[model samples]
Target chain A: DAGVTQSPTHLIKTRGQQVTLRCSPISGHKSVSWYQQVLGQGPQFIFQYYEKEERGRGNFPDRFSARQFPNYSSELNVNALLLGDSALYLCASSSDSSGNTIYFGEGSWLTVV
Target chain B: AQSVTQPDIHITVSEGASLELRCNYSYGATPYLFWYVQSPGQGLQLLLKYFSGDTLVQGIKGFEAEFKRSQSSFNLRKPSVHWSDAAEYFCAVYAPWGGYNKLIFGAGTRLAVHP
Candidate 1:
């Protein structure tokens, strides 16, 4: 049983560019969430999706969006990235939107210059 | 709103010594608490959780936590620390807001173990 997996482990983008991070959840998982972790800070909630529907969103701006597929995989996209957007984008998977038994992926390190 | 606080930014301890990490939470109802550990450049790993039942819960890697509703705290503890125990410890609480259950994490405490 593999855990949640994320890709583009490290990336660099221009301040005005856009970026997308992907995640694959555990086999039986049905919920997927995204989090952002800045340097020297803990991970903060971003978005959560269950059954291909947006269940909850954090305090992030409209520039950030996410979608979950039928297979419970997810993608987090950030548009017009700014220097402040440079952080570790983490994807977590849980059994459901109830937030029970969630697990996290290694995360994608995004650096905007 | 639900929130967590880790008063200690960093803590250093010697190997074979007991360790305690303080965590305080603010929530309306009985809180669903959890402790997570993250190594450098790694994702968060579940150390333990307190939902209901016994106040003291034992977790993997010899870690344990006790929930005290009176104090609004869920502190992580270990009987003996190891060099590998050096990592960032986070306290979190599950909240039901925006029609979905979410996790709110603390600022995190960095742990350093010395020989």
Candidate 2:
């Protein structure tokens, strides 16, 4: 079975630019969550979508948003990006709503210069 | 607020030696705990988890973790370490309350295996 897959493994953009990262969850998984991992830090929760609805959100500003499609795929969008936005964007998926045993994707590395 | 803490920022151990990584969590109630390992440029992989029942949980790649409720700690242990085991380890916790409960992760501990 294919694991969680993310698109544009690495991306670079200038400040004030917008970026959209894509993620496809594992087969048969319904929950997709986004996380941000800066250098020398652990992953921090961003947004979570399940059944095409926003389930939870982290402390991120309104500039960050995400959505899930009917196919269980997810996209994370960041607007007015700042240099601090440069970090590894990780996507995780779980089979149920319990949030147990989440599987992660290789992550999309976003670099804002 | 819920939080997870990994006391050690980095740990270095010789190959074939034993390994232990500490994790502590702060929450109002019983929380679901987990350990994940991330190799360089790779996604985080589930090492083990603790929900309820037995305190000892076994995970993939010969890894195990024990959950101590009193100490609010879940520490990962391996009988012997391999060079390939060198990676960043994360400790995370999930609350059981309603709504979209997200996992709170620690700062992570980097492991270096020396041959």
Q: What local lDDT does model 2 show for residue B94?
A: 81
For each candidate, the alpha-carbon lDDT, in order, equals: 0.93, 0.93
| List of clashing residue pairs for candidate 2 | none
- Quality class of the docking in candidate 1, CAPRI style: high
Backbone clashes in model 1: 0
- For all predictions, the C-alpha RMSD in Å is 0.7, 1.1
User: What is candidate 2's CAPRI-style docking category based on DockQ?
Assistant: medium
Model 2: CA > 4 A from native: B96-98
- TM-score, candidate 1, is 0.98
- Looking at every candidate separately, what fraction of the true A–B Cα contacts under 8 Å does it contain? 0.78, 0.85
Residues B47-80, candidate 1: write the lDDT tens digits.
9998899999999999999999999999999999
Estimate how well candidate 2 is docked, as a DockQ score: 0.77
Model 2 RMSD, rounded to 1 decimal: 1.1
